[model samples]
Target: MKLGILGGTFNPVHTAHLRIAEEVRERCGLDRILFVPAATPPHKELAGAIPFADRYAMVAAAIADNPDFVATDLENRRAGKSYSVHTLELLHEEYPQDTFYFIIGMDSYRSLGIWKDFPRLFELANLVVAARPGIPCKDPLALLPVVIRDQFCYHESAHMLRHRSGNIVVFFEETYLDISSTQIRRLVSEGRSIRYLLPTAVEHYIYRHGLYHNDERF
Candidate 1:
């Protein structure tokens, strides 16, 4: 089976997160899409980050109705700071027969080189980069640094980069809702309506836990 991995902080999983996964699965011909919430993200600010348990719960609640979607605790099951490369490596080892696709946004694609063991990540799975508003949707190879770009070659027929190591970067154009976890958190803090931004179950979960209340970074 082809697996699509969509990893994120998911401080609160929102509609866009679900939509992107759905689109990517359909476009990439993936049999399953796993939403892996990071236990401790390495690059982003975690000042007001929610606890791992709460974040994981929200992901589970958001994707509950979709049979094809799964909320995984892969990162939460591990110790220490989370790194994508390591996660992908373990996944490849465990599911040797599966073709894995690591999903990311265009913004993440631009900073791919700086990631820990980034070259090895490409070797483990194909990258499915979804375009978001304000982030350009272009040849992903061009966005990589010169050194990283040297490893990829655009296959005009495939419309994806065929890496020297047999890895491929699939640049997928998708219709994404302009919603963010940051914006939802800010609204909740301001006592504003967060309707339609995320699943109703997730909204209720946030309120019950008093999450992002005033954005105090507690």
Candidate 2:
């Protein structure tokens, strides 16, 4: 089985999120894409994120229509700061026979070395990075220590992750929706419309819960 792991805060699920999942599923021949919401990211702290339950609910609702896309609270359910390596380890254990491909943004991929047990993460599963339009592999190998640089290759697309080992695969897709949870909160706080920024259900949930009204950090 081939599983695609899309992990993020998902303070509010958006259409672009779904689009990326669909693209990966079809292009990468993935059997399933699990959307795992982060509990507390190691690099940054969430400021105005809606309650974890609410974020999880919105994610579930947004991906409910797609059988291939499912939401998992593995990171949120676990204690302490959420680390990719730990999550990958747990996922590997749960789906022993499945090939796990981690789907993430190119920005995250560039910072892989900064992550905890970065090399172990690659050993556990392939890393699939979704690069924004026109963004080159932002992280240069020259910046990394010699040993870690040797572990990765400047390759594009999920196919590289599937076919190659010891490297991160990047998939550059066109996504015009440059929206973020922080931006969404700002728009909502200013009484602006967020019709296309997120799913209708998620918008409704945010407004109904009065989230991000006073804070727009997350």
Candidate 3:
């Protein structure tokens, strides 16, 4: 089975998140897309101190109607910070026969160098870097971390890079929905309409729980 892993803080999973997962799943021929909400993201802080359970519930509700989409609490089960490398390693161990495609945005791809055990990520799974609005990654090779740059060879025709580990890194240009969790949260806090920005189920869940209602920052 080919699984696409989409990891995020998910403070509240928005429409773009679901669209990206679906786009990547179709583009990469993935059997399922795992929505792994980070328990404690290492890179940045959550917009508000929303509990992981609430975030996970929102993800579950957002993807409920889609049979191909699944919400997993793998990161939450782990003790420490939710690191992509660690999550990938765990996925490999648990599903040895399955192939994994680590789905990330172009912005994350540009900042890959700072991630823990980032080079090992190629060894664990193929990378699918989805293009984001305002983030241009025209030359994917040039953005690679210098230390591991030589480990991959670019195939211009295919627009992908093949790592020595046999895992490939591909760039994808999917339908761009400029909606963001930060924007949703901000809108909710100001008592504005958050309709259509996310799933109706998720919107209802957020309002029921009063999430982001008092947040001062976006």
Cα deviation at 139, candidate 3, in Å, is 2.1
Total clashing pairs for each candidate: 0, 1, 0
lDDT of each: 0.86, 0.76, 0.93
Candidate 1 accuracy as lDDT: 0.86
Candidate 3 per-residue lDDT, tens place, 25-120, comes to 999999999999999999888878899999999999999999999999999998999999999999988889999999998878999999999999
Could you tell me how far off, in angstroms, the CA of residue 218 lies in candidate 3 after the best superposition? 1.7
lDDT against true structure, model 2: 0.76
Residue range with the least summed lDDT across 10 consecutive positions in model 3: 131-140
* Candidate 1, superposed: residue stretches over 4 Å from native: 133-139
In model 1, the worst 10-residue window by lDDT is: 132-141
Cα-based TM-score, every candidate: 0.93, 0.87, 0.97
Misplaced by over 4 Å in model 3 are 133-136
Model 3 lDDT at residue 201: 99
Better of 1 and 3 by TM-score: 3
| For every candidate, C-alpha RMSD to the true structure in Å | 1.8, 2.9, 1.2
* Per-residue accuracy of model 1 over 16-50 as CA lDDT, tens digit each: 99999999999989999988899999998774867
